[model samples]
Target: MARSIKNPKKAKRKNKGSKKGDGSSSSNSVPSLPVKVWQPGVDKIEEGEELQCDPSAYNSLHAFHIGWPCLSFDVVRDSLGLIRTDFPHTVYCVAGTQAEKASWNSIGIFKISNISGKRRDLVPPKATDNESDMDSDSSDSDEDGEVQNGGSAAPVFQLRKVLHEGCVNRIRAMPQNPHISASWADTGHVQVWDFSSHLNALAESETEVSRGASTVSNQTPLVKFSGHKDEGYAIDWSPLVSGRLVSGDCKNSIHLWEPTSGTTWIIDTNPFLGHAASVEDLQWSPTEVDVFASCSVDGNIAVWDIRLGKAPAASIKAHNADVNVLSWNGLASCMLASGSDDGTFSIRDLRLLKDGDSVVAHFEYHKHPITSIEWSPHEASTLAVSSSDNQLTVWDLSLERDEEEEAEFKAKTREQVNAPSDLPPQLLFVHQGQKDLKELHWHSQIPGMLMSTAADGFNILMPSNIETALPSNDA
Candidate 1:
């Protein structure tokens, strides 16, 4: 496990001899508020502002690859960097190849060096569609980084091109395996591929443009699952289990697959179906191996336990409109976050589900439909949300949340089920300056770092005070 970042306890030290809310002073109970201290070594309680990133300057890919093209894509940072020492912190980006379809689609692998300071772009791979079309098969004009023919010897940036048949909807990498990933495509196909050799080769060479091809290398899906009847976008690998996988489609159905033998994966033909409308998204519980949750166009969120049966373990109507996306809180048990087309995002406590008071906090701050939501791995109460409004909001649910606010929320829930108090989760940072934002993900290794993609380009946002933002133990 990574070292837990601890906020300085200078505040607690200052108020060491304090009285408790119980009206007792003998025990030296902590006061309502801790003292404030500004020291040379310790970071103070400072609010962070969003910083826009320049892709070209930080060695990231341009919005367009071959030429200007509109492509539906997915972006995921490889969590393998945390467990594997040799693998650098990298991102796997898959974009639809409408223009470059005949040749190959680009699955760009970017290597990021440092993530502490002003966020810089990773080194996106160098890519050209065709192999034979290469001017020099194994040679380069400039060895010491020179410009030629109105382009740098290798252009500003190039991506390692991985070829697939159709458009890739999502890519879920294995939590334990650094070199394996499962990808679902618009062509109704699911593929599991070992990316070790290819990624190593891509990392070694500075000028190899076309390394990933169908004919060469182990480009085939080690195990392949057929596509859904309609659109198949949702897929996830269980973090608690090695090969337990779940996939959802647009037809209100979901399937679970488990590896049966060596190199053989047994996929259930019959889905664990329950949703009224299309299953929009799915998230495996961070703590439970057999338990998973799904959000649908029907505006309901349902939790299922495969060990118990196909029926839902718990269910709740999460939104008035379609629940577009959701995330299972990794750091805290029993917490789930979801976003809807009604331009509202909510966080719910599963323990309160049976009591009909599941919604703990909600915000209608976005005027457009939310596209993505992700809980921060480093902090339990922190999360990031992106919407069609082309903006991203990073929320710290623990910020300034006193007993009064929580008590009011409980009181409000008594009047109406799922009705939370007026106090919304505090906004730690808001990111604008992008159009039609698609996806946002936290850096697996760093506490306060995140990456987002949009119509214009990708932006890497890092708050200045992420190191000491969340206190180690809440009072």
Candidate 2:
């Protein structure tokens, strides 16, 4: 179902216009230099040295704001094909805003469309160069340049918001039905909202804006639960079952919800109590309907089987500090990833669980606390992580550098980049510029696409180097 889309052959660096004895021109001559490696809290730029992002490093990149900052958001699985690779993409998502005032908070359902950008093939460098020159000469050539050079264009979004009573701590959309979403509020309550009206309005508004302007819903939630002793950041809907859910709270409690009807759920009051401290996050097993996992502030990860009892079936001391997030690999059922407050993350093979030796790999790259982590739906070995250090990193566990390949790469890039020898070989891409990155998720339908949210705004980008294992339209 998946295929590599990139040309393994690297692009040739053209230096026809370079002048001899010019140090300034030497750096600009190397356009195909690898992405500048940045290590937060360790490296600082000296005077006259500046950090600049190479535009060619990304296939597509866009940044936008939605009036208020959102701490949590979920990508809504759409009717679009599960493996969509077309350009000018459209994405649907739901985000719960953390507004300045409690009453100012709202749940925003958005449809972002017309996301156009460059592909890896370069569209012929000569034509692209000419188009860039024309764009620089005249400001009116912006639209024309986009059409002629296949350049990026500003994406547009249509949003329908529902007024809420409190600031939302976390939100998740049902995978089976994207219109039904649940939000955990600071008011110590979890509420589910049906957003069919907003989605319908957005679908209709794409053609005519006036038709969908007044469809915003301010109605009460279809159901609400206040059984938890405190608010939490953990909530996830089961991918295998239609309406099944598991939520954890700061009070060291976990609850399960079973769908009784389309709009109603029966939450079990007898909570699963394995974690001695706050439950930081929860993730359902992709293959097992009766199984799930939870990470806690007490630095323990527990595996639960609802059929067994209220106690966890197995528990492991997963980290030295609070485990902040977890991502269960859907493609590879046995792999589980966890992030911690100590800025380290680890991958554990569930099948290797024996006497607390399940951790197969661990990394301590980020200086600040790890905030979010997610496995790519399209690639089993690939995952993305965001941290409080204002970075979003993509990693591929299947990558390992042999001595021959490392020497070859060093020979090619030695003049352009001075990368540290200790850098992890599995690190594929590192994205900076965002402030206080809170969360990130890969677009399951769109190959290689990733979206991240931060204190400032949101970023949607696709890295140019990583080969997406998918049947790309550009091919």
| Model 2 per-residue lDDT tens digits across residues 1-475 | 0001112221111111100100111122345753344444456755544444444455666666565777889999898688877678899999877776777778888888887765553222344877877644432212111211244455667787898778788899999999999999878899999999888877777742321242445779998999999988888999999999998988999999999999999999889999999988999999999999999999999999999999999999999999999999999999999999989999999998974599988988887789999998988999999988777888889888676966665465353444556768887777765666788999989989889877766778777655444567663
Cand. 1 Cα-lDDT: 0.57
lDDT of 2 at 368: 77
Off by over 4 Å in 2: 1-41, 46-50, 121-152, 207-217, 406-415
Model 2 whole-model lDDT (C-alpha atoms): 0.76
lDDT of 1 at 11: 14
> What's the lDDT for all of these models?
0.57, 0.76
**Superposition TM-score, candidate 1 onto the true structure:** 0.67
TM-score of each: 0.67, 0.85
Residue 240, model 2: lDDT of 96
Taking all chains together, the TM-score of candidate 2 against the true structure is 0.85
